[model samples]
Target chain A: MSKFYSSVTKKIWMSFMGLFLMTFLVVHLSINLLLVFSPTTNLFNEASHFMGTNPFIQLFQWILFAGFVVHIILGLILQIENWVARPKGYRVKAISEESFFSKYMIHTGVIIFIFLAIHFVNFFLVAKGIIGEIPKTLVDGKSVDDMGALVIALFKMPYYVIGYLIALMILGFHLDHGFQSAFQSLGLNHPKYTPFVKGFGHFFAVIITVAFMSIPLIIYFIK
Target chain B: MDLKLKIWRQPSAHADGKFVDYQVHEISKDASFLEMLDILNEELVNKGEDPVAFDHDCREGICGMCSLFINGRPHGPDTAITTCQLHMRRFKDGETVTIEPWRAKPFPVIKDLMVDRSAFDEIIQAGGFVSIATGGVPDANAIPIRKQNADLAMDAAACIGCGACVAACKNASAMLFVSAKVSQFALLPQGKVEAKERVQMMVARMDELGFGNCTNTYACEAECPKEISVTNIARMNREFLVAKLS
Candidate 1:
């Protein structure tokens, strides 16, 4: 039961990483929104180019990767530990409480993990010049790698669009629980303010999911 | 009242258990569930058959000794009472009712309708104590406390060490029980002295003893005979997090 080695500590770590990833989503969703909302394609290209080349962001990209890895690995371990805690189960099962969103956290998380892997292979590697070649486009009279074009091309394909929508939907559903649960795990619950937190969690989940969804729809419909 | 009982009969902790059907005729609905069981045992004994064994003491419900999973709910269909407090009227005449012991890894079946819940005692021993002493004959106002904190602490202390929370939990998590002890101490001035170490040790012991993590299901509150709040659990999560960080 040393400070860092206990289950409670593991929970604190999970909550910390989870909240950090949640904050990252706000920045990511805003950037991706340019693919749909901006009148000119240059905004997306410039945005993607800047994010790709910024040294500070590049350092943060590594921390972001570490965040995903730690959350997923520790999430799996904590899940396994919980399973071991209950070797025997009820004969006549009764579920009197717990919301559906909270109940399926692990399943949705695994889905999100699978989606992240596919997403990085498709876009992140290309943006980093690690996997595939990027098309060239002009932004501000300078030839820039057309990361936005790649996004458009990928979104035009029916399966990619469908998968993107599905993953975002699950992510939305997960955030519905994750936002508040993370706070609660960190012991942030209170009688006066928890309802507000839950409401904000709902709003955040919808906004992020809808924002991500708008990208594919706008790309396929407009261009 | 005539009733068809489907009771789990297990000989020992490691032995296989299953439901055995029995019919009891002409019993009064006024009889408590345990009293009905006594009648059923009398019939079996008279017929040269082995009598069913179940645990009960303080049938008034304070002891928390009776642990039965009756008709898919802990402590029978009645809310806020133990199995011994449930009267046969809750069941219909000629109805088939299923009864089983508390189901959890930490609570192993010892015999018919009884499981070993000593794991609870082990968890309590981990930190469920004040371990502080004040000089005798202190004034009542010596340690002035806020009414709200005192009342909440008393609420958490009302838990009867029942395993219903574990039985009702999907993961068999003892978070309610463990958190009850944590909350009781966390709110009290006396228990606050070693609060950090207390939460750490109790939660660690809980995890080590194979109790599941709390999903905040609130089933523990719903099934608790004493109606303990999951807020204590919220408080425990807060205490555990702060303790870990600070």
Candidate 2:
């Protein structure tokens, strides 16, 4: 319970779980984006079928689910603890005089979490067979059926695309702080690698935001 | 050189604090900023008024006792070096300087330019140490620390535990201070035995003390008198992950 409740330890937990979730995002984006390059339904279906049936992937799915739960719950808990601990807040007026991202993490993280819920409802539910099957789409001038088509079709909705882009932007903001910060929490920073890590973190955030948002734009305009 | 001073004055930690304005005349351009303050204090004493209260000892800047936010930046307008080490030459003859104490909620103003930094002590007491013991100082070659690791450890150890990092931080985070300590110990073979517990305890204490989380704005490092790297924070996180899993 102490491990669960300790705010500092929770930060370690958050960083640990977040790194795993980051890997999951990479895997998820790779598999979902198969609609654009994979020229055949059987291949996409075969990939999805493999994902649905693989034992190692199934274990990873459970771990990923746990990661999401820990990330969200502990984030909220740590934030609440911070609020309760510093009810008086800083006496000086400084943030407006400094960086903007330092002050807006909570707002951006909350928005991202809201987007996460929507993502789960639309994609996770459909993938798990908890929700009704989404309608298929015509890809490369042929009627195709699979999870990849569902992703492409969902992005075709203008409102969904807008929401997704906003979510990705918020995620970018979160990563701007989180990427370097996680390493700091674990005490991994050093002079030789610190600048490189920060540069890489910013680059990672830009890449992820662009990659995630590009899918929706590609489906709506290019495809 | 003539200079304008806007220094914070509080009767006590319980008393309300406010900035009081004063003027200094015929100051040497080469004298350190604290010398200028000393000149003003002497004038005030000659005038039969109480001298201003500020923290300083070595005045060489390593003690970490001289914590001040000058003109919205910690340790004056300079990139590094504490207020004691800040030379007055940086400022123009007629420039107005604003001096204030560390403003974080965890660091309460004791009086004038000095704030209570016991929260840092508390964080250290919670974990920042190596519990292992040797009978006496062992041979230097016994623990062959790689040159890279030794340098990194020395760099982390360079942190003066000054609240300047906190003062400069927009979030008022002590991550730079905490991470430096964690990294300093974790990098050495002597400190590795307690690495797991040290990170866990130190971080818990940091959060427990009501300090805000690190947002990696680099403001702390930018304002640090020692220019402590934010990389220590990253190293601290990596150590914490290993601790959590194992």
Candidate 3:
């Protein structure tokens, strides 16, 4: 147990949690895309209903929550340790030639955390009946939470849409460094495959950002 | 070449330091960066001023003794060379140059431009060696190491224990240095005997000494005089994780 508390071990945990969250984003974006592409169909509501009510996902939801909390906490702990490592800074700031996305991770992470808080309050809490009422609509004569309606309505507001876009742009930067960083931390780096991993991480970051951003933009403009 | 130098002037480790500007006239562009400093120190001594103290040995880049954060770089403006290897030609004649000691907490300023890097030695003491019975030198080719592994191990061994990686890292992480040390042994059969305990002990000592965690920024690789790859860091991470788990 004492061995698990080492710096490397902490990073390993962070990597696992971060990679898990990355997969969760894929599932989340796929379901959220329904708000734009399949607005007229019952697919979006059905998926939401399944996500909200399924036994497996319901259990997994807590695990997913734990992943986010653990990742954030570990990040903070590492950052604090990093701060203490350099008590006195240099008179001339050391210039960074590359990995620009890597430096401001904490700043980007804080923004993402803020966005997550607003997101949970607006959607997750409402769905859980903790904040506001969950809007309902009949799906095949079975009543379901109108998550699509709630999302579409929120996206319709220019302020919310703008904030979401900004938050996601920051998230893109965070993921840009994070994707390959997670793999590197997990000790998976190799000369042959590391270049590909880095390239793919950049590609993945852009794809996830653009895909998630398109939902809000399309909903605000066209829907 | 004539240049203005803003050099950190700390009398001792406990003294508050500040950048003191000086001018040197008619310095040859061919002089090494340290030789240029030597010229300034000589002039200072001629005027009964305290000569600036810094560390250097073997003027070749191998010893890794000379350290200066020159113009915001670990070893001046050049890449892949130590301070002893950096020439005055890299700088413009009239440009202002800044030089200071490595600024990590563990590497406290000893004087003007020399830092206490003995922390690195302590980390090495933790677990940087393989225990072998005292005997005659082993026969050549007796170990039968793979050529690829040998090359990789040599690359990791090239590290000179300079704190430049720590100096270069924004977090003052010694991961690149520690990783290189760990990799040098982990790749060869001789090192495999105690690789598990070696990695764990070294990393624990590194953390106990207040070195920052690697954030995978690759800054340490960029600024390393030895050009030690961050892959060694990845390998160290692998070795460390396996040690912790098993």
Ranking of all candidate structures by their lDDT, best first: 3, 1, 2
Docking class of 3: medium
Better model by TM-score, 1 or 3? 3
Residue B158 of model 1: what lDDT?
92
Writing each residue's lDDT as its tens digit, candidate 2 over B154-209 gives 99999888898888776577888998999898999888989999988988888767
| lDDT of residue A184 for candidate 2 | 62
Q: Highest DockQ: which candidate?
A: 3
Segments in model 2 whose C-alpha atoms lie over 4 Å from true places: A1-8, A38-63, A80-104, A121-133, A136-160, A183-200, B1-5, B21-28, B42-50, B92-96, B123-150, B182-207, B234-246
Q: Can you write out model 3's per-residue Cα lDDT over A79-196, one digit (the tens) per residue?
A: 9889998998888888856589889988999999999999999989988888878778888999998888888888899999999999999999999999999999999998899999
TM-score of chain B of 3: 0.98
Question: Model 1 in CAPRI terms: which quality?
Answer: acceptable
Residue B121, model 1, lDDT:
92
Every model's DockQ, to 2 decimals? 0.49, 0.27, 0.69
Query: Candidate 2 versus the native: TM-score?
Result: 0.78
TM-scores for every candidate against the unseen true structure:
0.93, 0.78, 0.98
Q: Pick the candidate with the highest TM-score.
A: 3
Clashes of each: 1, 20, 0
Estimate, for each residue in B82-179, the C-alpha lDDT of model 1 and write its tens digit.
99989998889999988888877788888888888999999889888878784587688998889999999999989998799999887688988988
Residue B139 Cα positional deviation in candidate 1, in Å, after optimal superposition: 2.5
CA-lDDT, candidates in order: 0.85, 0.78, 0.91
Judged by whole-model lDDT over C-alpha atoms, candidate 1 comes out at 0.85
